[model samples]
Structures are given as structure tokens and as C-alpha cells.
Target: MAINVELLKKVCEAPGVPGYESKIRNMIIEEVTPLVDDISVDNMGNVIALKKGRSDEKRAMVAAHMDEIGFIVTHIDDKGFVRFTTLGGFDPKTLTAQRVVIHGKEDVIGVMGTKPVHVMTPEEKNKMPKIKDYYIDLGMNKEEVEKLIEVGNPITRERELIEMGNCVNCKSIDNRVSVFILIETLRNLKECPYDVYGVFTVQEEVGIRGANVAAHSINPDFGFGLDTTIAYDLPGASAHEKVTSLGEGTAIKIMDAMTICDYRMVDYMKKIAEENKIKWQPELLTAGGTDTAGIQRMGKSGAISGAVSIPTRHLHQVIEMANKDDIDGSINLLSNCLESLDKYDWSHK
Candidate 1:
């Protein structure tokens, strides 16, 4: 079960910031169409692909968000420097000195700027960063900037996917990596134990908005949020504080700020992983949430839910990294889990 690195790279590099998800959505839909029996894009912009099963069997769902954290142009100064606001969350420190593409009437390449240290007071050198301290320079005059760029144009980091020794690096890997996992799982799936819905949701960076809408319409007996969990296997982090380690395996969610994975479902996933010889690990995220939370609480009554997380490093940054082994392991584990659901007793006993 090798991950198609080429596919993952295309997904990671696509520019989609919250409200502007059409580009990423079309890419997902085009690739997913051949793998599923039926597919549709809901009004909320969720690309839902379905693989049907026995009439009497329970339905299942898997979701991965397609949106990336980025910014939108708020104003263009007289010097062609652009002021922007984040469409989703970002660590202010990572926003400095990076290049971005402003998606407008025509895509414009720009560089993020900040005051040079040569003129900064010693006290200012030690100061923290604020979004206000940054601006984007498009290298054009005020007339050229205003004539071409709109105030609401979306902006995305200029990044290329790189294959490191054991990992892949790029932007949008937070959820795009999970999107890759879902698509690959569907590609390899032979037959489903029950009807399975694979949803590529939108606006997850702003909130789990698309999932909230999709879950209600395609209510399932069980749900799985395919997403990335933090991997803090670097220096200065204690053992327990490291949510997950890269290359160890696919992460089985136990709990996160948004949802505590159903204990029975957690055991079910672990059982399949062991049976299939797929590497697996447990994750406990301290903050942030996933579409799993939305599906778990959708409709009048919730459904059984859990998440399969790819362990990622440098989350919400320009250089998000995911292990190749983890990607392969997740595809295998999730495919097996989906195929085994019909016979597996979801009962509490």
C-alpha cells in the first residue's frame, strides 16, 4: 500500500483558503469520481462520494477537510504593500519572510515583509510578532496593484512538496494528507462491508462547517474523520507531550479538544490494524478539532465515531511534514477497517 506521492503533492500545492475552496474541490471530485459508485457536490461544497453495499447493512462515512489556513487581502497601501487578514489560524512567526500567491483576476506573486533588524532598537529585537507588523509586497506600483488585485483575493503560501529521507514536506498537509489517505483508501478498496461515504469537506479551517452539513444529510451508522494529528517527536518536547511520532504508524484517535473517539470504535480500528499487520498508534491532541466532532454530534442523535490521524509535524506552517510509512499504513488500516464493519458487532458488549 504505497502512497502516490505525486497525487499528494498536487493536493498540497492547490490554493484553497476557507471560503475559496472551488479549486481544491474540483481536483478532489475529478480524482474521486472513478473510485465510487455515486458522487455529488452539496450546496455547502462538500464532495461526497458513495460506495454502495447490501441493502440491510449499516452505512458508514469517512471525511477529510479540503481547506487550508491562509489569508485574504484586506487593503493595498500606496506603495503596493498589501494588508491581509487570516482566513484561518496561523502562528504569526511563520508568516514572516515567506512568498505567497494572491489569487485574483490574475495570480500575483508577492513576498511577506517586515522591518529589517538593522534599524530595530535592541528592545524591539526581542519583541514578539503581531499580524499588524507584517505586509505583502507585490513589487508593483500602487496603480498596478489596485488595478489588478481585489480586496478579497485569497492568498496561499508558495510551497513545493519535497521528499525528505523518510517524510514528505509541503503546505496544506494538515488535512490534505488526510484527503490523500481517503482517496487512496477508496482506490484500493475491493468491496465494502456496508455502504461507505467518502466526503471531502470544505471550510474545516474556519470551523468544521461542511462536515456539519454533510453529516445531517448522509447520516451514517458510523463515522470516521480522516485528519492529521500533531507529531512532536522533535527536541525539547517531553515523551507524553509528543502527541504522536512520525514513522511509528497510523494514529488512532483516543481524544482531542473536539471529540473523544468512541471507545468501542477505537478498539475496532486497533483490532483491524493488528489483523492486517498495519502499523498503528494512539493519539491525544491537547487542542484543535476535526470533522469527527461534527459527525459525532450531527442530527437529533449522534452516531458512533472515531478518527484515523496521520502524524504530522510543524502543523499550520509552510513546512508541514508527514511520514511515508504512516501514509501507507493509514490507507491499509482504514481499508481493512471499512471492509470489516459488516461482521463486527458494534454493540457495547
Candidate 2:
């Protein structure tokens, strides 16, 4: 089946930052309401959808967080400049010269302003850019700025989905790619070999907070955390640290900074990819983590957990990109895995 590129475009551009996911959440609720057998939103704003299987064999949970890294207004200065506390991770170097949308009284467009290089000293030029050095300039004076914005307004990088050759580029692709996978899986999925929980979680960028709550509630037998991993396949990085490259295919995680995957779970996904001839790569991220860690450690005995990551480039930036083929490959592997869950020996012992 053709992946829903139009639906994906809308999802990617949807406005939702960490702890402020209403716009994205409502959009997701609308898209997925009809596809699943049962669905609910938890206190944490996690959208949980369940599709029943032929038998009550075992529950398999897949998480794709809906939140993106963003900023919240902390101060509106006298000169109409806005200072904010970052809601999630952003390289200060990339913060400068960025166009952003501040959700104040109304949506206001602003640029992250920084000192001009011509006025910098030699010492300042050699130093790294600090978050304190940057502020959102709404181009309004103090009176107008104070009247329009508040101290707690959220701000997000302003970007529209851009199709670049065979790839799609935009912000929030880190988790939105996974969200797309879950939505399409449910839309296309008719029968499951086992009970499936598709969770579109909130606040993953701040922490795996939503997933933590969802996993505890479900106490799944098997868990798959879907997310995007770094594809440092650029000019200067080594292949060893490239993690997973774009266009290669889906990523089967072996290890990352947060969790060492269960061997059987890793083997399970990898084997499925191989048998089905789905393109995939083994991911070994040296840093960062996904909800897989939180899911694996849930309940008293915990659950068998693993991950399927979309190989992506320029993670956390407005220019983040992922290949169409890789997205298709992940969808294929996960749907196939869900349909054939009973076919595998997923015993804990």
C-alpha cells in the first residue's frame, strides 16, 4: 500500500511542543479515532488505541511519542525581546537565526536574534553560542510585546513540510515518523495475531514521561518503541558512529545510551525483516535514548522491550530529514511483525 504522504505532511507540520500537545493530540485523535477497536487518552494525554487479536494470547505495545522539543516563554524584555526556557534539547549553535512561532495571545512569528559577528571580540568568536545570548525578537516594542505575550507561552520552530527529492524535511520528524507508522499500521491493520496497544504519547521530548505511565497501565508482554535515530552519514563522521544511515531502511536497535535491547527481541525484529526481505539496519546509538528503556523497565518483572527507529539526519533541527524508502521499510516490518507475533517464541525465559 502507498504510505499516506499527505497525512504525513499534515502530521509533521502540526504544532505541538512538549507539555503543550493539544493541537497535535487533537489532530491525532481525529485521524485514529475510527481505526482502532478501543481508544482512550490518559491523564498524561497519551492517546492509547487497542486492536484486538484472534486470541487473548499476549499484549504487544508500540509507542510513538507525539511531542516535539520546543521552548516556553520565560520573560518578555523591555525592548520587545523574548527570553524563554527551552522545553527540550536544542544545540545553541543552531538556535541563532531560526524563525519561530510564539503562541502568545495569538500566534506571533519571531526570529531567534543573536549578536552580529562584526561586533564580537576574538574571544567571543572562538566561544560557543550560549542559550542566554539568544532571544526571540517579535519586532514589537515593550508595551505591545507585554500586551501580546505572557511568561508561559510556548514557542516552536516555524517550518513547513518540504519534500526534498526522495526525502521529507521538517522539524519534529524525530517522533512524528513513528507516529505516522502507528497511524498507518492501525489504518491498514485488519487483524492482529495478538492484542496490540498503539500509544501516541506526550512529553517524550522532556522525558519518556507519557510512555512510562502508559506502560505501567498496560503492563504489556512485549513492547516496541518507535522513534527516529541519528543518521550521521555526513562528510566528516565515521561509518562506525554513523549509527543508521538514511535510505538504508528501518533500524533495529541493539544498543543505545538508555537501554541494551533484549537479545531475543532484537533477534525477533531483525529476523522478521530478513525473512520478509524488508530493508533494515542494526542501530547502535552512542548517545540519547527512546521510550524503549521506559517500557522495558515497567511493572515488577518488567516487559520484553525493543525498538524500531527511522534513520534520520539533523535531528532536533528545523531541517531534520528522513527518507521515504526508510519510512516504508519500517511500516512494512512492523505490520508484518504484528500480524505474525504468535509465530515467534517470545518467551521471557
Candidate 3:
């Protein structure tokens, strides 16, 4: 079965930033509960769902993070402007004039404002904008703003998912798209050899906190991190530097900054793709990491780990784009991999 675009849109637009993932976690639990044999949330707020296999010995863990990059209220100025700190990695260039939702006592709408270019000097224009130079304007007086918002409330980009041509664009597609894929795969698994653990992790944007704990607890024989990878296949990018191209296929990571994929697992994925005629590309990311980095080293001796990535453009930005075919292909490949896991000799190097 293919991923439902409407469901994908909802998951991408849900408000969940790192530690503040209760909303998104609850949504996932509702959709995934019936398909899996059991499900529960852990202390770190990671949602762990299970689908029992024919045998109980071999287990496979598939993880996709639910948190997205956002901000937290740091200080409220006398004039009611809110100063904030980023909760995850962000480019200052992408902050100007963006709409945001401050999850205060009540939802507060705000806009990120900066000095107008018309009033700036050439030197000022040449210098890059800094996060410190910007503040969220709620258009309220100091007293009113103070009454409505606290210093610790989370703030997220206020953008809804839109379908453009053959792609889907949204703010939090970085890993929510992966979550959709994992859920769809489990729904499509008619029969499998090993027990499957579908984990929707939290705090991955800040650090791989949820995956670390989940992996250590489950101790699966194999693991896969489902997440998005940068697709630098746009204008102004050199051919060799493009990490992976959009619409090509789902990416199979050879190695990335955080994790070196197990050779046997990589080969296993490739073989399954070829046998099933699913489109795929080999990925080698120069920078950035995913939950795979944390899962590959968790528990006793660890499990052989690898990742299946969707090609995404403008990742971590409001208008992230991904192809429909790539999303469908990833679901097929992951489901096939789960069905054939017990057939492989995982202990072999």
C-alpha cells in the first residue's frame, strides 16, 4: 500500500518540537495502534509499537523521529517583542519575514522581523543576518504579551503542507515523511520472519536521545533509521557535490558523517531493491547525521544498522520538497527488507 498524501500532510504540519512532541506522538499512536500487536510510550516520550513475527528470537527496529526544528521563548522585551533561542540547527538566512506560532498559554501568532534592506547601509546589507538581530512580534503590549506567553513555551513555523505538481512541500518533512513511510510499511506487512519494532522517536533534532534509549532497551538483531537526506540536485550545485537527486529513488546510505553502514546490511537492501524492481540510489552524505548514528552503537555488541532515505530539497526550511515516487519506493523497499530479515545470516561479517 502507498502512503496517503493527506495523512503525510497532516503529520508534517503537526506541532512537535523536540521535548514538546506530545501532540504528534498522540497522532501517531492513533494511526499505528491497530496495525501493530502492541504500542506504548517511553520515559523520553518515544512511541514504541510492535508487530510480532513468526518467531520471537529475531527482532528488527525501525526508527523515525517525530520532532522538528523550532524555537523557545527566551525573553520578552518591554515593548512585547519576544527574544528566542533555536531548539535545533537553523540558518539565519531563512528566518526573515517567516510566520510562526508561539505555543504559549494560548496559541500566539507572530512574525519574525528584521531591519528593512531599504534603510540599511551597503556594509550592513553585506553582513549576514544574525538570530540575535531578530525578534518575534506578537503585536501586543508588554503587559498583554507577558500575560499570554511564558519564557519556556515552544515556537514553531506556521506553515501548512501544500501539494505542488508532483511534490509535497511543508516545514517538518525532514523526519515526519519517514514516520509516514514506517507506518505504511507495517500496514503492508502481511507476514514477516522476525518481530518488528516501529519506533517514533523524539528529540532527534536536538540530539539522538530517543533512539539511543529505545535501541538499548529493545536490543534488536537489525535496525534501520528512516529519515530524509539532502538533495543538492538543484540549480547552482555541482554534479559531484549533489548528495542525491530528487525523483531518482529512495536513497540507501553507504556512509554519512555520523554512521558507517554495515556492508552486509547495505548489500541486503540493494539486493532486495533489485529483486523487487524498486528504484534506489546509493547515498554518501558529507555532513549531517540521523538516528542511525545512535542506534548502530547501542546495546551489547549492537545490531547491524543502515538507513533508507527519501531525497528532500531545502531540508529544515519551511518549503521542504519531496517526490511522491520516492516516498512510495521507500515503503516498498522497507517492507520487503523486513520480510526477508530472518533469512539472512546477520552474525556474519
Candidate 4:
């Protein structure tokens, strides 16, 4: 199956920082409304879309977070430079020389600026960069900047999605790509044995807040988290360091820093992928967690949980990339898994 690059592009480009996810949440609601039996937004802003199954004896929840790493305006300097604090984790060096959009009264474009290397002393040149050292230059004086910008505004990376070779690259691919995958899965999934709750969650980048709330309410029996995983298949990485590789097809999460995947779910996913002939790889990341952690344990009685992880390169940076084939495989795998949940045994091995 071919992935929808246009939809993926729109999803990846939309701005929705961790605590400020209104923009992306609205877009998700619009796109997913017609594809499910029923949909509603929670008080916490999670878009829960339910696709009724053949029977409601069991419930399955799948989470794809809509929030991305971004910045919140802290202060404006006397010369019009914008000072901000990160809304999520960031590699400090990635902020250098990047363009960002500040969602103030009006959208304002700014370039991240720091001291020029030409003027740096030897100690400064050798030291690693820090977030405090950067400020955004909006090309306007203080008076003009104050007219349109203020503290508390959300700011997001300003990169547009584009196809490169056989992959798509853009900002926010860390979790937005999974947003695309979940939307597509909801669109393609057929009748299943249990209700399928496709939840486009918010504030996942900050602490899995949205997924935690949704899971508590739904208390699903089975769960799947849709998110991207590291793909350090680059030049300097050793074979063992490559947690996953692009174009290796969708990844079946074994474990990560926050949650250890249920062994039963892992076996079920692997069995399904092999039986369906979907190419897949195992992901055992030692760092970073996804909404899976919330879905796995937040529900009453807990849930058997695993994750479908898209292999992403340059994760958390503006140049995040993922293979189109891998994305399509993710959609295929998730749709099949949701539709065939009744075929598997729930008995503990």
C-alpha cells in the first residue's frame, strides 16, 4: 500500500507544541471525523475516535500523540530578540541557525541567533552550546515586536515536509508521522471483534499527559502505541547502536526506557507480522519513551500493550526523516492487528 504523502506533509507541518496543541488537534478532528463511527474531544484535548467492532466485549486503544517539541516565549530583549524556554527536550546544538514560527497575535518568523564563531574565544569554541545562549531575531525593533508578540506564545520549528530519495523529511516527525499512520489506520481498518479507540493525544512530548488521561477513562483491554523510534543507521553508528533502520519496515517495540512491553503483546505482534508477510524489525531502545507507557499502565486493571514504532532518523531535530515504505508498512500492520485481535488467544504462555 502506498502512503499518502500529501496528508503526511500537512500533519508534519502543523504546529502543536506539547501544552499548546489546539492547532493540530483541530486539524486531526477535521480529518478523522468521517472515518470512524463516532468521535469526540476530551477536556484534556484528546481526540478519541471510536470504530465499532463486530462485538463490544473487548476494547482496544491506540494512541498517536499530536504534540511536537517547541518553545514558549519567555521574554523579549530590549533589541527585539526573543527569549524562550523549550516546551520539550531538545538537542541544544540543533537550535543554532534554525528558523522558527512564533504563534503570537500573528505568526512571526524568526531566526535563531547566537554569537558568531569568528568572535568566539578558544574556550567558547570548544565548549558545547546551550539553549540559554540562543535568541530569536525577528528583524524588528522592540516597539514593533511588542505590538505583535508577547510572552506565553508558542513557537515551533519552521521546516516544510519534502520527499528525499524514497523518504520524507520534515520537522516534528518524532510523533507526527505516527499521527499520519494512526489516521490512515483508522481510515483503512475494517470490522473487528472489539471496539477500536483511535486517540490522537496531546502533551505526549512533555510527559504522556494526554494518553494517560484517555487510557484512564477508556480502560481498554488491549493497546497499541504509534510513535517513531530512533534510526541511528547513519555513517558513524555501530551495528548494535542502530536501534532501528529506515526502510526496514515497521518496528515492533520490545521495550524502552519507561515501559517494558508485555511479552504476550510482543509475541502476538511478531506472529501477526510474519503471518501477514509484513516486513518488520524488533525495537529495544534503551532511552526515550512513548505514549505506550501510559496506555500500558494507566487503565484500570492495566492492559496488554505493545507499540508500532516508525524508524525515524535525526529524531527530535528539524531534519527528521522516515522511509515511505516503512510508513506504509506501519499502516498495514496496525490495521491488520486491530482487525484480527479476536483471533489471538489471551491466555498467558
Candidate 5:
């Protein structure tokens, strides 16, 4: 089945930085409301949707964080330059000459500005740029800028979602694509063996904060983390360095910097994918983590946790891309896994 590009586009373009997710959270609530038996927003702003299963003896929690990497306003210089601190990890080089949207009293567009290479000294030309070296140019003086923007406003990349060669590209695809997958899975699900808690969490880019709170409350027996992983299938990448590849398949997470997936959960996911003939690959990211960490260890006794990772190119940048087939396969795999949980032994070897 073809992925829903329109819905995916809306999800990717929405602005929702860590600690501020009302926009995306509201969209998620609307999308999953009819698909689930019950839904509610928690105090921490995580959107939890419940779909009852045939047997409620065990519960499963699936998390797709709503927040994207962004910046919070810290200072506005006299020249109307916007100085901000990053809310999540970013490659400083990506900020060069990029456009951004500052969400303040009203939405305003600004351009990322940096010292031009032509004016740099020989030593400076050879040095890599840092986050501190960049600022947002609002094209207004301090007086004019203050009317629309101020300290504490959030800023996000300004990019529109576009389809290119069977893949969707846009900002926030790292996690928004996963949010779309979880919503679609819920819409397509038939019967689950255990109650499914589909959670659109917040603050994942910062520290997996929302997932920790949601998982603690749900205390699920099984957990699935839905997020994106690097697809370094570029010209210069070595085979080993290509963590996963675009259009190859959805990735079944083995381990990342912060969490080692439960061996049983990993095995079960692999088995389910094979049984259903769903295309998949193994992912072992050396750095970076996802909500998987929180979902795995936050529960009272901890849950058997693994992740369904979309293979993304140019991750954490405005041009992130993911294949349509991989996205469709993810929705299928997750829906099937939720329905067939009762069939798996889930025993330790």
C-alpha cells in the first residue's frame, strides 16, 4: 500500500520542539482519536491512546515522540540578530545559510547567518564552525524585531515536505514519520492480543523525558520504540558505516548508545518480520539514542523493548528522507506485531 503523503507532510511540517509540543500533540490527538478505544493527554503533554485487545492480561506500549530538534530564544542582540540555544543535538555545519521560523508573538521567518568565508582569516577558514558562531537574521532592527519576537520563543527549520524518487524529504522526518506510522498502524489494526498504548511522546530529542513518564504510568509488558535511524548509504560511506540504507527496509533495532534491546524482543521482531515477509534490516547505532531507552527501563519491572526504525538520510537536517516502501512496511510490521503478541512464547532462553 502507498503511504499517505499528505498526512505525512502535515506531520513533518508542524513545529513542535522539546518541552513545547502543543501543535503536534493536538494533531496527533485528532488523528488517533477515532482509531483508538480511548485517548487522553497526560500532564507532561504526552498523548496516550488506548486500543483494547482480546485479552487485557498484558499491555504493550509503542512510543513515537512528537518533538523535533529546535532552538529556544535566549538573546536578541542590538542588531536584531537572534541568539538561541539548541534544544537537541545538531551538526553545526547544517545551520549555514538555512531558513528558520521563529515562533514568538507570531510566526516570523529568519535566515541563519554566519561569517562569510571570504572575510575569514587563513586560520579561521580552516576551522570548523560551532553553534555559537551562528545567528538568525530577522532583517529588522532591535526595535522592530522585539515587536514580533522575544526571548523564550522557539525556532524551527523552515522546510516543506516533498516527494523525491519514492522517498519523502522534509524537516522533522526523524520522528514525525514514526508518528504517522503509529497512527496508521492503529487505523489498520484489527485485533490485538494485549491492550496497546500508542503514545506520542514529547522531549525525546532532549532526553527521552516524555517516554519515561508515559512508560512508568502504562507499565507495559512489551514496548516498541518508533523513530528514525541513520541511512549513511552515501558516496563515501564504508559498508560498515552505513548503519542502514534507504529503500532497503525498515530497521529492527538491536542496540544504540543508550539502550540494548531485550534479546527476546529482538528475536520476536525478527521472527514476525520474516513470517510476514516484511522487508527489514538490523540496526546497531553506535551513538544517539531514542525513546527506546525510557520505554525499556522506566516501568516498574521494566519491559521487553525493541524499536522499529525508519532508515533516514540526512537525519537531524531539514532534508531528512525516508523511503515510502520502508514506511509502509513499518506500519504493517507494527500492526501485525501488536495483533500477534499472544502467539509468541516470550520466554527467556
Candidate 6:
């Protein structure tokens, strides 16, 4: 089936900066509600949906975080300029002159401001821009800005998802794209052998906070983290350092900074993909992590864990890109794995 670009765009553009994931949470809840047997939001604002299996003998949790890397309003200066702190990881080079939305009492428009090149000293032009040196300009004076905006407000990039050649580009596609894949997988499942829990987690950008709580409460027998893996197939990156390449296929994690995937789970997914003709690629991210790391060691005896990742380029940037084919492949492989869980043995490894 062809992936829905419009739906993917809507999910990516929806505001959900770390702790403030209500809007994206609600959007996911609506899409997943009909696909699962039951659904509700957990204490940490995770949208948990359950699809009962034929026997309920085993429980499987599939996690896809809804939160995105953004900024929070830290202080507002007298000139209506706002100083902000990052809510998640960011590359300092990507911040200059980017458009952003200051999610205050009402949404306030702003732009990351910097000294114009015309007035910059030669030394300043040679040096890299610092996050500390930047502030947001909302085009309003101190008095007017104070009455409408305040500290602790969330901020997001103001880019819409768009299709270019063979890729889809947008903000928050890091994990929101994964959320879309998981929900679509469940929607296509005819039946499941093990009880399935589709968890759209919150606060992942801050520190995998929501998944920590949801895993403790549900305590599944197995877990699969659906997320985006870096695709470093760009200029100035070495072949060895490139984690995965765009359009290759869905990425299966072997290891990352935060988690080492279960060997058995990885093998199982690879076998299923080969037998079922689903395309896939192996990934080893040297930096960063995903909810899989947290969920793997979260419960009574813990759970066998793995991840299905969409290959992405320019991750954490406003115009992150991914291949449509890889997304469909991920959905297929994930759904097939969930359906065939009864045939696989988990206790041994």
C-alpha cells in the first residue's frame, strides 16, 4: 500500500515539544483508537492502545515517542526578544535565522535572531554561532509581549512537511513518523498471536520519561521501539560513519549509544523480513538512543527488545527527510513480526 504523505505531514507539523505533547497525543489517539481493542492516556501522557490476541498468552509492547526536539522560553528581554533553552539535542549551526513558534498563552511567532553579516567583525564571521548568543525576536515591545507571553512556554520550528523527489521532509519526523508507521501497522493487522500494546510515548526528547513509566505499568514480555535512525548519506560524511542510507530499507538496530538490541530479536526480524520479502537494513548509531533502551530493562524480568527504524537524513533539522518505500517496508515487517510471535521462542535468549 502507498503511504499517506498528507497524514504524515500533519503528524510532523503538530506541536508536541517534549512535555507539551497533548495535541500530538490526541491526534495519535484518534488514529489508533479504532485499530486497537482499547485505548487510553497514561499518567505520563502516553497514549496506550491494546489489541487483544487470540490467547493473551504473551504481551508485546511497541513504542513510538511523540515528542520532538524544541525549545522553551527561558526569559524575555525588554525589547520583546526571548531567551530560550533547548528541550532536546540540537546542532548549533542549524539555529541561525530559523523561523520558530513561541508556544505561549497563545501561539507567538518568532525568529532566531543574530547579528546581520553587514555589521559583523571579521573574527565574528569566522567563528561559529553559539546557542547562548542567540535570542528570539517576536516583533513586539516588552509591555505587549509581557502581557501575552511568559517564561516556560514551548517553541517549535515553523516548517511544513513536503515531498521532494523521492523523500518527505519536515520537522518532528524523527519519531512522529515512527508513530505513524506503528498505527498504520496495527490498522492493517488481521489478527495477532500475542497481546499487542501500541504505546505513543511522551517526553522522549527530554529523556525517555514517558516510556519509563509506561513500561513499568504494562510490563510486556517483548518490546519493539519504532523510531527514525540517522541516514548520513550526505556530503562530507565517511562511508564507515554513515549509520544507514536513505531508500535502502527499514533499519534494524544492532546497537546504539543507549541500547544493545537483543540478538535473538534482531535475528527473528531479519528472518521474517527475508522470508516475507520485506526490505530491511542494519543500523549501528554511534550517538544518541531511543525508547528501546529504556523499555528493554524496565519490568519484573525485563523483555526482549528490538527496534524498527526509518532511514532519515538531516535528523533534528527542520527539513528532515525519509524515503516512502522504507516507511512502507517498516510497517510490513513490524506487522508480520507481531502476527508471527507465537512461532518464535523467547525464553532461551
Please give, for residues 65-84, the per-residue lDDT of candidate 1 as tens digits: 99999999999988889999
Greater-lDDT candidate between 1 and 5: 5
Quote the positional error of residue 170 for candidate 6 in Å.
0.5
Tens-digit lDDT string for candidate 2 (1-349): 4567898889988888988999999999999989998999999999999999997767889999999999999988778899988888888898888899998789999999889999999999999998889998898998988887999999988888888998988888978888999999888776887899999999988889999999999988888999999999999998687988988989999988998999988988988999999999999988889999878887456778889999999997766999999999989888888888778887756
lDDT of 2: 0.89
Candidate 1 residue-wise lDDT at 216: 93
| Model 6 spans > 4 angstroms off | 347-349
Q: In terms of TM-score, which candidate is stronger, 2 or 4? A: 4
Candidate 4 deviation (Cα RMSD): 0.7
Model 4 gets an lDDT of 0.94
TM-score of each: 0.98, 0.97, 0.98, 0.99, 0.99, 0.98
Q: What is the C-alpha local distance difference test score of each model? A: 0.90, 0.89, 0.92, 0.94, 0.94, 0.89
Model 1 lDDT, residue 299, Cα: 46
Candidate 5 lDDT over 1-349, as tens digits, reads 8889999999999999999899999888888898999999999999999999988898999999999999999999988999999999898888899999999988999999999999999999988999999999999999999999989999999999999999998999979999999999999999888999999999999899999999999999999999999999999999999999999999999999999999989999999999999999999999999999999999999999999999999998757999999999999889988888988888887
- Model 1 clash pairs are none
Per-residue accuracy of model 4 over 227-339 as CA lDDT, tens digit each: 99999999999999999999998999999999899998999999999999999999999998999999999999899999999999998876799999999999989999999
Candidate 5 C-alpha error for residue 298, in Å: 0.6
The RMSD (Cα, Å) of candidate 6 is 1.1
Q: Give model 5's clash tally.
A: 0
